[model samples]
Target: MNQTFDVQGMSCGHCERAVTQAVKALDAAARVRVDLATGKVQVETDQPREAVARAIAQEGYQVAAA
Candidate 1:
């Protein structure tokens, strides 16, 4: 599944890496693209959207409710 999430608190490369890693932790094969400027996170994964969002949230970022 592909999902786009509105995530805040991302300001640098580290933030992008954090979000990507968080998503990857859930599904090793998942693809994550974080656009800090737009506060958008695009993810392609087999996991559920909730699980992916929770992972990003657990990384200290705010995942806006969709």
Candidate 2:
């Protein structure tokens, strides 16, 4: 499944890497792409939406409503 999240508080490459790492840690095969300027994250994984949201949140970013 593909999920798009409106992530807040991401302003730099480090922030993007943190979000990507957090998601990938949960699903090794998961693919993550972030648009920092737009505060958007696109993830491809089989995991549930809540799980993905939690992972991103754990990285200290807010996941906006879809």
Report per-prediction Cα RMSD to one decimal: 1.0, 0.7
* Residue 44 miss distance in model 1 (angstroms): 0.3
Best by TM-score: 2
Model 1, 1-66: lDDT tens digits are 789999989999999999999998899999888888899999989898889989999999889844
Candidate 2's displacement at residue 26, Å, is: 0.5
TM-score of each: 0.94, 0.95
Candidate 1's clash total is 0
Cα lDDT of model 2 by residue, 1-66, tens digit: 999999999999999899999999999999999999999999999999899999999988889756
Which pairs of residues collide in candidate 1?
none
lDDT of 2 at 29: 100
Instruction: Compare the candidates by lDDT and give the number of the best one.
Output: 2
> In model 1, which runs have C-alpha deviations exceeding 4 angstroms?
none
